[model samples]
Target: MHIPDGYLSPQTAGGLWALMVPVWYAAGYKVKKTLSARQAPLVAIAAAFSFVIMMFNLPLPGGTTGHAVGGTIIAIIIGPWAAVIAISVSLTIQALFFGDGGILALGANCFNIGFVLPVTGYYTYRLLSRGAAEDSPRRWFAAGIGAYVGLNLAALITAVEFGLQGDLFKAADGSALYSPYGLSTAIPAMMIPHMAVVGVIEAVMTSLIFVFLLRNNPSLLHSYDGIRAAATGRLQLKPLLIGMALLLVCVPLGLLATGSAWGEWGAEEIQADVGYVPQGMDRYLGRWSGILPDYAFPAAEEADTGEEPAGAVSLEGVKESVPGYMVSGVVGLALVGGLAWFSTRLLTRRSRKKEQLD
Candidate 1:
């Protein structure tokens, strides 16, 4: 649930930013407390997974399409803080390079999908899996349900934000506005079913990835395995079959997202809410808002469906969001990998010099 620009007032947008800073700090602090050595590689891998999965959009029966949020999966693998960082980085890449989302709304998007989804999803999973054994059917079931529900909750919050900012459902008399598909209808119409389908996708994907990492690399699951394994049994292959079924559903959905089907379905519902449905929306669709609970500027075009014009926000204009994505991948590798190698060699030479001294 991305909040398109124009949905939020400047005051509301700024207030959200003020609130988000503290939350981001808290998330990072928690990550520092929980991080471990083996977890580092897994963090990088999870970031990569988030990047790739979002690329494949699924079509819905409705004209609109949806894709996996990856928030729950990342949270399951690397605590919610790290998940936020990962998703934020991935989103920056998508927006800057691909022009999928608006530059003005990156922070909003980060807070919604990155912070809201994962933080909420993590605690929810814990609450649901409270008493299950490791690999127990109960734990798995709890995890899936928790993930599914968490996404919907986040989506609902996002819808409300839209309603507040854009007058999504206000009538002249201050009653619920009516539409062939107005904001009143769009809120539940778009959010409930869309989020439900997404929740299932998230749940199965989380379970599968959880199982995979558990069997092949238990260390990767270290953060929550203590709690999760205590509830379930151990990760196993049965979820693989479940994952496949979910994936099958996802494939057709992704095809539809990239195709015209998603547009026809989702557009009808969304269009009913707009004071004047901007043509730019046809391209921005899912990428319109930053994440949820905030406004991300919708992608803009001069004439509906073509390249953006000169005045539109561009990769160069949105430097805050891109630097980390463009440079961090290389710099992080160098500092984490190259520096380690160089430091080792320097230490070895010093030791050799000490031997000569001896």
Candidate 2:
């Protein structure tokens, strides 16, 4: 669930950022200590994988849309700390370039999906997958359940954040100044779909990936100390690369979803639904229109002169925008992948230098 800019009060956004800054630093410290030369690129691949998976939106109940964040699988394969790095990278790129999430709210988004999702799943899997053999079915089962739990928990937290905004921050007229949905409305609106549908999709995705890795390269699972490199050959990138390439090509399928997510409605939609825009939210709306807003290249000219927005999601819009969407997917993949790699390289290199000095 990507919270758009206007959905959150600046106080909420800033508080989340203050909490996240130390978490981010600690993630780097942990990843640098644990990430080996061979493991560095794995984080990059995981970041790109997470980014692309998030593009494939699924239709949720109440006419809203949602997607599977692959944070749990990344945590399983690497570690929760590295998952933070990988997921944060993916989310930052999406917010800055594609307008998937808000630039100001990136920290809050990362807190929900990047940190909470991975850490929840990682610990859940660890608790259940403990003492299971490298190739055990129990482990993957644990991973699936962990994913379901993690995704739902993250969604619940997101709902709470949006819910609190309505009550905590308000105009003099007693209208909400940010998100208009209070706890009762926001929680059910978010939780019902996630619990019924989105969480299941996330669990299935994680289980399948974990199964694939188990069959192909069990050693890639960092938490499994029993299956070290002594038994396995060099980590194979070709299979993972092929899978990501195919997903990139098919990203346009995400346009098939019909509605925006619950907390991601635009200003006009907010006005129509609630009778007015919040004062604070109005000021922050479209605070930063991303380069490739909503993952499409701007048309040379407006595609239409009609009631709906030119970039509105429809069958015709999907048909027209497929090429741009695919290109955007490719661009996102490269940016997240490269930036993730660079982050690992920088952190690991710094750790190495410190060791040399010692």
Candidate 3:
């Protein structure tokens, strides 16, 4: 689901940024208004959960793989506005540090996963679970259904983003300049796996977590059903910490899945597979390099011999080693978790100061 650099034209990427800036601002304002000191830790933990969950990629029927974003779950647990901040933070770290996503396409990526998925999923869950109690089976079922539908919608939007590039940007010979595949190819290639396997994973994950939280620590679910657990001055952090630890343990499962995503291929791989790389992709995709490109560190031998490292794995047509993937996951978790925690703490302090003045 991480659209690497060069997949989108400058216009498309810029357009997405323009669309998202105001959305991000509004989310920040809304979150600031509603966020309490007690809920600060919840936002951070939810962000960490979103960060780690995206690491577990599920293999699809085709040679490609996708992961559950956990956006909707975060939205349901926290508010959609807060989910926006959490997911955007995670995606920003992945793009800037790990190179999991394109730098230029960060706006598009955040818009898809951070904005579209959470907002849509949150609303869907609310609509379906409206009359039901938070602990009701119907509410859980609604969460599952909402997650499934929300993830697919995000996938569909991503497909359209890719498809539009083909029509809007092309070479003199009518060849695509950025993403080569039109809607006919992009939609099916991206949506099938989500509609089948990935969606189910997201649905199950959301429902199970919702149930677990509801049973053990209903206070953590303050965002749902307008419940104010903080009124008691006791916040349950143990369950969330335990869940985060478990997710860390399961991070390796992402490596077990083989094949790259449908449209995230590198320039060399795209050219070899399609006989020619799209001009825009070839030009802009490799423009920026991250500390760990493809989550792989070049071997010391490569520095000495000036040759490609032997530790490279060709899973996504990139030389990403297993150790590199593990390191990237750990580092990403720390950075994202730290940022979320720090930001929420600051927001809480400011909110407190404002209340004192009031």
- Which prediction has the highest lDDT against the true structure? 2
> What Cα-based lDDT does every candidate model obtain?
0.52, 0.87, 0.81
Candidate 2: regions farther than 4 A off:
226-233, 305-314, 350-358
Q: Kindly list the per-residue Cα lDDT of model 2 for residues 212-302, writing each as its tens digit.
A: 9888877788777512351234677789899998898889899888778888988998999889999989988888868888888777116
RMSD of each: 11.2, 2.8, 3.6
After superposition, candidate 3 runs with Cα above 4 Å error: 223-227, 300-322, 354-358
lDDT by residue for model 3 over 94-159, one digit each (tens)?
888867788889999999999999989888988998888767898778888888988999899999
User: Residue 31: error of model 1 in Å?
Assistant: 2.1
Lowest lDDT sum, 10 consecutive residues, model 3, at: 300-309
Error of 1 at 204 (Å): 1.8
Tell me which residue pairs clash in candidate 3: none
**Candidate scoring better on TM-score of 2 and 3:** 2
For model 1, the stretches where C-alpha displacement exceeds 4 angstroms are: 168-183, 223-256, 259-358
Comparing 1 and 2 on lDDT, the stronger one: 2
